[model samples]
Target: MSTVVNQTTPHRSGSVAVIGRPNVGKSTLTNALVGAKISIVSNRPQTTRHRLLGIATFAAGKDAPAGQIALVDTPGLHRQQGKFSASAMSKVMNRAARGALEGVDAAMLVIEAGRWDDEDTLAYNVLSDAGIPVLLIVNKIDRLRDKSALLPFLAQVSQGRTFAGVHPVSALKRNGLDALVKELLMLLPEAPPMFGEDEITDRSERFLAGELVREQLMRQLGAELPYATTVEIERFAEDTSLKQGELLRIGAVIWVERESQKAIVIGKGGARLKEIGSKSRLQMERLFGRKVFLETWVRVREGWSDDETALKAFGYE
Candidate 1:
């Protein structure tokens, strides 16, 4: 028998950059749009280091424009070139910013409702300089009980500059998201479907798995550990059970900046490492819906964030 090949026609869709300060629900919105975990989200600031693309295909929906919307999740914009450090790490962040801003038809600037500070202004400035039309997304409105409290901030932000529109939404609570989606669809260029009917995200399974692990690490180890850690999936194998069973074994390497940090990650007698592994495995299994055997190890790479070679290996380039 001869093998058959199928080709998918790539739809012409516009890109929208989701830019904001760290922990402002940018990744959460990306995942919400894709209807899957295309980007890893956590409470830690600057959790995302790369620009991730999540394709939202809308053939026919209440808010469907001419076609679909491709949402680009970007790293948080912050001051990195100083004694406080992480400017070297900010190289990746800058790459993400540039990647999302370039050739995007529209952009979404996410901000927290309770607090709008210098970082928020800096993020807006970066996008303004990019010369792209932006939709101001005031996220986490659910955090405010009065809800009217956001009006002052919105009006102030609006007066400063002209936005496509101002939308107060809570990506965490999934409130006012419909309105946001409608606004996005109206702003999105009229194009065809970009991906298949069933395809939701642009990231590969392995990449998402790595991000999930990173998110769990951030959640467990707090701000200090996750920022210093990077995960690389060394081996991924899908094997059928010996008899009528299904499971997958995933082996990955978790890289840290220092051995001391490694000690903290591993914890006393490896308790912390085990906890990370356990939580990560559950997430992987949920995403894959199969028995997942995940193995994690810690390695040290000095200045990996600034290393071009290391960045290339991690697909930052």
Candidate 2:
């Protein structure tokens, strides 16, 4: 006798937390899957301090149901010790990452292709212990010179883990992403769509503006100021007057932990600050699809990264 299988369900929707070590391309993968830049990306480690949600909706095809995958981009999991200034910030970020992992139907543990470190092990242990279906996403595959080396690396990483699937993808180049999404959709639980199909991310424009500014600062300043910089949107106003080209006015403050850092950000003759503002404003205009008038101010917050209360006020909590 032949057995019959039911195919009645036509939708799948659930949350999948993207956890990984610092600079492993978790944010890049999140943006690629969502088809929008929801999370900021930088070469610096621990750049993502918040639990950012990027929602990706997949249309129903002849073989499968429609699905919505809520991708939670989280801070990198790492070992921090001592009473260093960054310890408090590290703890807060780790807490946020842990919270994002809890109650999720699935998890995507992103790691750099052809490499694994202690931090990666730490992240893997956390995800495996969560008792949820884990998907191993080996990102940055395009950086590898020898394509044939990926399989052995994948097999080595999958030895004892209970991963539902393993996918090698280059998020920057959008390679192997469709197949990755297909597997992710299969892992999601059957349910109604959690968000509109057109929606890409859960972050507000105000938050995105701040992130854009911070991203420019990180890219421009390079190694000098990535860790010491933070951006706060002081005022974000939309003009409904239909007056000419400018549709939005944004005022932001770039907060540094010390006065010396402020000077560094402002640069010689305020030129660096101007460049940062110009780049950030252009990005904001593209993001909002309108003309933006942005003004940025640099100020010293004095140990804000280490101060618990200051961190909370800055939304890092």
Give one digit per residue, the lDDT tens place, for model 1 in 107-197: 9999988678898888888888988789999888888887677888787778868788888887877777767776777776656666775
Superposition TM-score, candidate 1 onto the true structure: 0.89
lDDT of each: 0.77, 0.86
TM-score of each: 0.89, 0.93
Instruction: Indicate the TM-score of model 2.
Output: 0.93
- Give the poorly placed runs of model 2, Cα more than 4 Å off: 1-9, 82-86, 243-246
Clashing pairs in 2: none
| Candidate 1 off by > 4 Å | 1-13, 59-66, 83-86, 240-245
For candidate 2, lDDT tens digit of each residue in 1-317? 01132257467899999999889999999998888888988888777888999998877655556688999999888777545324678888888888898789999999999999888898999987899999899999999999899999998988877788888899999998877877788888778898998898888999999999999887887588756778899999887687755599899999998888888999899999999999999988887889998999999888777778988888885
Give the best candidate by TM-score.
2
Root-mean-square deviation of each candidate, in angstroms?
5.8, 4.3
